[model samples]
Target: MMAQPLLCEVLIDPERAKGLSLQQWDLLIRQARHADLLARLAYLLEGQSGVPTAAQRHLDSAWTFAQRQAQSVRYEVASIQKALSDLGIPVVLLKGAAYIMAGLPAAPGRLLSDIDILVPKPCLERVENGLLLYGWRTTHHDEYDQTYYRQWMHEIPPMKHGVRGTVIDVHHAILPPTARLKPDSSKMLVAAVALAAEPGVCVFSPVDMVLHSATHLFHEGELEHGLRDLVDLDALLRHFGDQSGFWEQLVERAVALDLVRPLYYALRYTAQMVATPIPPFVVKALDKLGRPSALISSLMDCLFARALRPSHVSCDSQWTALARWMLYIRSHYLRMPFHLLFPHLIRKAVKKRQGSGSLTEPIVVKE
Candidate 1:
């Protein structure tokens, strides 16, 4: 069967298009044309002047007013970083902020709507309280919603600053309770390096950062409309290369955290889309995690169906299914004792059936 025609225009910039192979060009254009992705696309296209007319038109069509909104977000991010420093909480700005601070040339033009900062788990309350004092407050919700954010979620309630109106996502962990897998944030903190020339500010080690990005996409099940995120995984892999023990370390880390399945999805999608270099040893390590069975595949399909493989783009139901299974299998492996699993499952089902009600309701004895 013939493949669907790619929407991005042909590359006209000789220099910009120079080192890229045909497949790389295809990935770039496809990523650039992603819906809700004009900011990131504009950032990637900044240095190249001779973009194809067709691609330029496609980009123009995708651009939105959010570009201006991102500017305010950027300024507020800088201020928040300074504030975090003042409170003696070492902050590592993740994703959107890190990309900007790196001076990647692929920065600036991209739209950034939020500020993500990481603090040690022990310092989580202190950091949240500090941000509050600096005028960042939680969303208005009932006690249940607050409890959900403070207890179950990896991050605190999304805090909005009074003056800036900018949202800050303060993370103490990378995954949510629903993810069923957890990485050691403490270990990540220890391996982190201070942001270049930015004292008291730090970011994850390159491998951890990349893995975290992949996990964010995989666990969030947000790939169906994820052409830009695919580009992110590609860029990180290409930038990091295979010279480092990245793949092996990633496998080991995933196993330690019981996150092997997400790692599998990450490697598979990255390889399929960007042809990322995966060393032989890394492939060998994946063997231990085993491949997903048919049952696992169907489960992943349900999870990522709405998140990653939206029909408007590509119908990657097969890929989504496979990813979902891997995720579920990993979740099963990550579970504690059999006894704990059943009770947890029952509680979750009951909570889910409560239908948007907060989990704060207390159970009472029958009269």
Candidate 2:
């Protein structure tokens, strides 16, 4: 058996898996699955020779499942595009859907649970009504929940297709309306590029896509999938960084969008953890935009390094839990002011205790 490779190393350099024992392979597969990265591992190892038969079988199975899911998601997206076509709404895909629709390298072997689309805020109501008419209904029917989303949330309450059971998140903005930093949605819409293959389907410009991904990852409360999200950032940078002038454009756009902080953290951590190659000039430019203090930087490094690792039993530690909680609190703090956050947290806690609120809360409708 060869020496056991670290998770990051195995991802970056699949040849490192050459001589692993069956037990080691098992552990790696389990860890990758737990991190929502099994399909990515499959993609990396598919063409490599000398993989153990058992590991090969696991990889094949994972790849097949991922491909099936990706197809379904694409079909759902097409149907959605058709449904909203008559409204003349320019449907801008976000996150997983965006990567897949744009045919980015990050698309293959990706798993998607919900389809996210952004429309202009002015047409949000019309879009919702159109979706409802097409058999997509809100999942939540509670009055307070409906009010909460309309008043403060970035997206409407998630809707599900009546017949297909597909979930969709319709957004008019990237961040919550109440967030301290609001990127100009209209500007993002203006810069969106139309998909050549799919009429009415569009995606963010490369720079804005990276900014939005960074913002989503850093501002999210959930850390269980932090590792997966980081991997996405790494993949995105590698794919888009190959273009000439990409780095300069990315930095300028981040400044224009007030998203330099998230870009800084994304570049910093991807460089540290995944050995992502970042240009020195880009680093210097971002540093001039305001780098964190040494103490704060050190603290965040500790927290993120731990939280962004695979969240399997073998990886668990007291420090990991503490770091995740701290980051969770930090995410909420970044999302809203204390005056709003306190009550929001309290309401969430109450809902959780009552077993009424889950990560995917159903939309509430009133009579």
Candidate 3:
């Protein structure tokens, strides 16, 4: 049996690419694409010699496309900040935009489909209107989706640029108002680090960035980009893990934010899959603080072991589909109690039955 996907092996040790056959490179590229890590692979393998000419061409192309996309993100974010600058509220960039603006290690080779930002909850309406006046319009025109986002979910309906086709998600919080864990958005906002390069723009502190990435991936209904997100966590950790007191700050911050579980899963999976260098003391700290029940822990190990693999034929067993499905259901369950989740499931089921189903949530999962 294949113990790990070739892409994962290459990720942990880019030198593995030095000896691969062209046929193996073909398979690796396909798997990396499926996992949304093709460009990331290119970035990691850069400067490494012995890549076949054909493979090098594809990697170069992927990296170039990613670079172009990253540049576009910068322009779009500037427009977004300018749109809301008059409102006088600090605009907190989230996810990809944040990574790019903050110059985090996760920014390079990342593909961003939309721009996300967080503002104070009280400024939600004003921020929405501010973007509206700048020619950004809300998407998810369906009434149910509008309500689902405005009422329960983390952010407002996704807003897109009429001329540029850029999408922006403005948020008051990371997780939904209805979610099980209630991390204090106010606390996070206070700790947000202002970007020196982009005045009036800020990102979560290093600890919060890692915690939010973990929470988003583990709580998401879709696992299509699971491996990609895990890679982001790996980058964030490796980068931040260097600062003095970073490991202790991570533990304390997770406790303060009530995000220990997601942090635990992030650290464990990144270590398992990417060979992310996590210290033993940090693992021991979380093991006591956030470890699940024995039965649940074993089940999670089984499920994520399968679900976190590259979603490709060569990388998975027949059980992979089942694992993804179960994790999807589990994500919904984790976010909301049965009472709330059941109705949403039924509504979505009816839509699927009618053959016009669309997820109420945005394509990119919110916290």
Candidate 4:
């Protein structure tokens, strides 16, 4: 544990680049790309002491894409704001979109797949209808798919803009009702902070923001972007760590939100992977609510240590694929109760078999 991965070492001290040979830089670049962190590393190393010209070109290209993505997110947010304005629904931005709008340190070079927003459950119909009017159409056409989403999920099926091809995930809650932990959506909605710079756009309060990000990553099935997400957690922690009572508030909110488990996972991995600074007392406070048993903790360490590394070939051992598959199954197990889960998994397997080589290919499973 004394030595970190090269990518983590470089992130912790960008000045370390002065010592890395071209071959090392090549491996690092590949690692970052597979982790979905090439751009974030680029942002971190921009003016650091020694970056080779060849590597700079690749980093620069990623930076350009990140810049365009930020601007595009802004335009799309504005369009969404306008679309919901008349209905008086508050659009609570989440994750990447929230980071960008709020000018969080995490925003820079943050690559985003889609915009996510939260509205009250009562407003779901109105919000969907309004978005439809703005050329956003429900993309899931299957009857079972629609029922699966509506009957037992956190958010509805994703909506894609007919014209722009951008996707949005609209949520009324964080965790699905079927999920083991259910945080009160109403409290988050009430506590949301409005972005004065961008009217009509609200984001989770600082503590809520941190908790949600933790919950999103640790509770999810997929881990291909695991390291990128761990980086996001590191960034948010570093940015917010200095605020008065920030750590205390984080611990308190995690308890209040039934999110201590995710918070523990977040704190542990961010610190382990990227050296994210978290107060010892804050970690200690969650011993009862968050910490797993010693045996379980050791097992998770084995899984996450492999799963959270870059998915690049260089990072894998004989067990890497199995580690990720185990975590994927673990996430789905935590997502819903057994009565619904067993049947759902069987149905999905059957559908996958039935849809092979057809236009109605089975959905790529995700949280």
The alpha-carbon RMSD values of the candidates against the true structure, listed in the order shown, are 8.7, 4.0, 3.1, 3.3
Clashes of each: 5, 9, 0, 0
> On residues 1-367, what C-alpha lDDT tens digit does candidate 4 reach at each position?
3235688788877888787899999999998877778999999998876788889999998898888889999899999998998987678999999999899999999988889999999999999999999999999999999999999988999999998888899999998898888789888899999999777789999889989988988888789889888988898998889899999988988888889999999999998888898888987887767899999999998999988888888888889899998998888888898888999989988988897867432422112
| Number of residue pairs clashing in candidate 2, backbone atoms closer than 3 angstroms, sequence gap of 3 or more or interchain | 9
Stretches of candidate 3 exceeding 4 Å from the true structure = 353-367
How high a TM-score does candidate 3 get? 0.95
lDDT of 3 by residue, 66-168 (tens): 8888888888878877888788778889888899888899999988788889899998999988899999899889999898878778889999888887889
Model 4's TM-score against the true structure: 0.94
The TM-scores of all predictions, comma-separated, are 0.70, 0.94, 0.95, 0.94
- Lowest lDDT sum, 10 consecutive residues, model 2, at 358-367
Rank ordering of all candidates by lDDT, starting from the highest: 3, 4, 2, 1
Per-residue lDDT tens digits of candidate 2, residues 1-367?
Answer: 1122266778878888888888889889888888888888999887888888988888888788888778877888888887888988688999988988888888877876788999999999989988898889999899989998999888999999998888899999988877777788889988999999789889999988999999989888898887778788988999999999999999999888888888999999788767788999999999889488989988998898888878876676678899999999999999889998899899988988898656554433211
Once model 1 is optimally superposed onto the true structure by TM-score, how far is the C-alpha of residue 349 displaced, in angstroms? Answer: 14
lDDT of 4 at 353: 89
Worst 10 residues of 3 by lDDT: 358-367
Which residue segments of model 1 deviate by more than 4 Å?
Answer: 1-34, 42-74, 104-110, 177-179, 222-225, 294-367
lDDT for 332 in candidate 4 is: 84
